[model samples]
Target: MDADTADIATIGHRIRHFRTRTGLTLEQVSDGVGLSQSQLSMIENGKREPKLTVLQSIASAIGVDLATLLVAEPPDERTAYELELGRAQASPLYTALGLPVVRPTKGTPTPTLAALVGLHRELARQASKAIATPEEARRANTELREWMRARDNYLPDIEDLAEEHVKASGHVSGALTHREVSVMAKHLGFELVYVNDLPKSTRSITDLENGRIYLPPASIPGGHGLRSMALQALAHRVLGHERPESYAEFLRQRMQINYFAACCLMPRSAAVSFLQEAKKDRDLAVEDFRDAFGVTHETASLRLTNLITVHLGMRMHFLRVGEDGALYKGYENDGLPLPTDVTGAIEGQLVCKKWSARDAFTQTNRTTELYQYTDTPAGTYWCATQTGRGDDGGFTVTIGVPFADAKWFRGRETTARAVSTCPDPTCCRSADASLETEWADRAWPSARLHAHILSPLPTGAFPGVDDAELYSFLAEHSGPLGE
Candidate 1:
């Protein structure tokens, strides 16, 4: 295409690309820009060029700078090597490797090995005068990759160290809520957006070059208070390294970081050991596990589920109660059967009654039930249980662990034997029914589980730690929790 046609085509591509990336429909964009949908379509198809006023309006409507729509280069004129170099430059992995494009020069000593040289040295040289010679660059790339691998491998220990540092600085404070942390992140270049009704126990953190943003479970549709607690933990963990980026990329990176964080905090080996120790003591109790591992209750419960489901051979599930007296964070492991196909609670009332009663017991009638109270650094959990066989003959265990009064489990024996039978007659075989409707409802169990679960407690909960200490702890532990 000629220069004029190429410019128009580029503009068209930009408009379409931005619109699709932002998830805006043509009609919606057209209405916002005061243009007919057909007209917008023509412009995007490059059949016609929009007037200056129209271009300005389109840019404004789409929330993009006008220059973004105007920048364009003809495809035919673009150098293939330059494009390849561009791709390499945009990749975080490649950038971290310190590989830059190079241009051959008369007196310049080039690496004899083809793989050691970048595709476009001229572009790289123009881009950065500080780049070293070919040999130096190659060595640097190798060293950088090794460093990155080491960092990724040791992230958990690094995070623990960071957290310790923060604690020692005495900067921790209860008033430093997630919202406040989010606001601080925005000041550092992150734009926090909430995604309502997310599934339970699910969260993500995105690293957008500008900064990082965390999507707490509470922001998800079915999230509970635990979601907030998780976010709080994360805020403390990744305070210093939270960089900002564009919105979409930010969400993507946050998820990647969150997964890494989870893996780091509860490494597969540590989880297995913790579960083995807990099982040996017959103490699936949160307090017992917390003391054994020196973690908060929420961390312990999460670790418990991970252990039972991921590490152990048993299938496991979890639920947390919300303000509406309903269950949230209904999660199940791969080996177990899900009570139902839906993501939320099956029955209307709380699901813990099946195991909460004193006469309730465990069975293998394709289903087993148990009730127990768990304590965490955050609070106490009144949990109910159900286990059933899946279609493939594998077992699925569901536990509805709800936040409740800490006193409820006060007198319950930590080493109590499993009950033999469930006394509730209204219970159903359909796993689809709500816990409240399936069985005879009983009074909330008295508190039996207790411990300082919500520890390194939010700032005000402790006496000596200050904001500096809290920030320092988070920065140190930003990478991972346990090795």
Candidate 2:
């Protein structure tokens, strides 16, 4: 009936149930309890809290123990429906709608009660879902990134698993072949199947019962190739991930699978040895690393992030920035301070325009990687950014290290360098004095916003996937496995 009485609604329902079961009328119970009949009715309807003596007298009059009336569960399915309806009507969302609350009677159909309860549940779910703001998502992402950073971005256990699986696939070389990936899948009791009608929300779907992994036949732009994606799907099973219940868990699982994929493609011992040789030659280059591993530049850069610090004795930083200067992903144990929001999230925060990650977009040499040294408040750092076009737009994958470590890397002595005192607006974000004065009041520029930056992370156990669509896809595809 009201917020104050919401907690005791179940108690009211129980009292009514026990009273009716004993065939005691409201008037009879009130008479025995020495309260007005209206008072008894109010208590039964969850509109009033009867005193301890009044409750004792009611229990005595109804021939039941007080504990029985105080039990948590509704006495029956019908009472459950009534309790749910009362809760819905008492909620702030319902009251704020300014709609008349439905008071169900004995004559009200069971279907009507069921429908109202279902609608109320959906309303509450939607309300809760909306409350998961971008800030919450960023905080989750930031925390997960911090957790990864804590271990120097190296997971020896995961690395061991990747090495064992790769060796099992009979892989002893450079790039992990598609055939080797298939071998690993077969070794793990999974078969890779390509389907055109895969769910849009999912990259790869594993039907565990049927021992199949369904993927798209076509390659996705700015995404992992078939081998990497397959390895990732297999990684899920290897890592023992169930459906994630929160955004943080989802991010972690995603990172783990990607990490596993990287480790598989570039096994720990081999990749580190390759880097060691590159360092000996004073010619560490991300492009050569990408070429050697036959993986994307971003993938190579990320793999380097995992190994360079732990194995190569070099503190480093990696950044993936969009053409619009938004920092899409970043990691650093070196002192290059990434711009962070109040929540310590780096994604969606703008990288300094003076940084090589942003300036690479202006470079005329599209075929070659752009390398530069940036002088920041922290120190001078040498970075190489490779600009590429994706389905969304242009982006850059940059890997960098402190000036001291630059001696071991290629492109260490380039004339291209700039100063950045970022995390300060005047460093890059603010317009020049003449430009600001001329158009500060005249400009009414509309911001081109990314929808994901404002929207909540998708709701449900698996986060962004549609359960019904995935289940149907799995069922449709599983029939062939039996054959």
Candidate number achieving the greatest TM-score relative to the actual structure:
2
Model 2 C-alpha lDDT versus the unseen true structure: 0.87
TM-score of 2: 0.76
What local distance difference test score does each model get? 0.44, 0.87
Query: Which segments of candidate 2 are over 4 A away from where they belong?
Result: 1-132, 218-224, 481-483
In model 1, the runs with Cα more than 4 Å from the true position are 1-259, 292-294, 323-325, 334-483
Give the per-residue lDDT digits (tens) of candidate 1, residues 350-457: 333333321232343423345555432323444544332323333223343333221222233333332212113234223445665755465466653212211222
Candidate 2 residue-wise lDDT, 1-483, digit = tens: 234332467877888888888898988888888889888888888889877777778889999987777677788888899889988998888998899989889899888999999999999987675444688788888888898888889999999999999999998888898889989999989998878899999989988998988888845543348888999999999999988766667778989999999999889988998999999999999888888888998889999999998899999999999998999989999978999977788888899999999998888887788889999999999999889888789999999999999999899889898999998888988889999899999989899997787788666777778888998987777786545
Candidate 1 TM-score to native: 0.28
Query: Per-prediction count of colliding residue pairs?
Result: 75, 0
Candidate 2: give the clashing pairs: none
Q: Estimate each model's TM-score.
A: 0.28, 0.76
Error of 1 at 219 (Å): 24
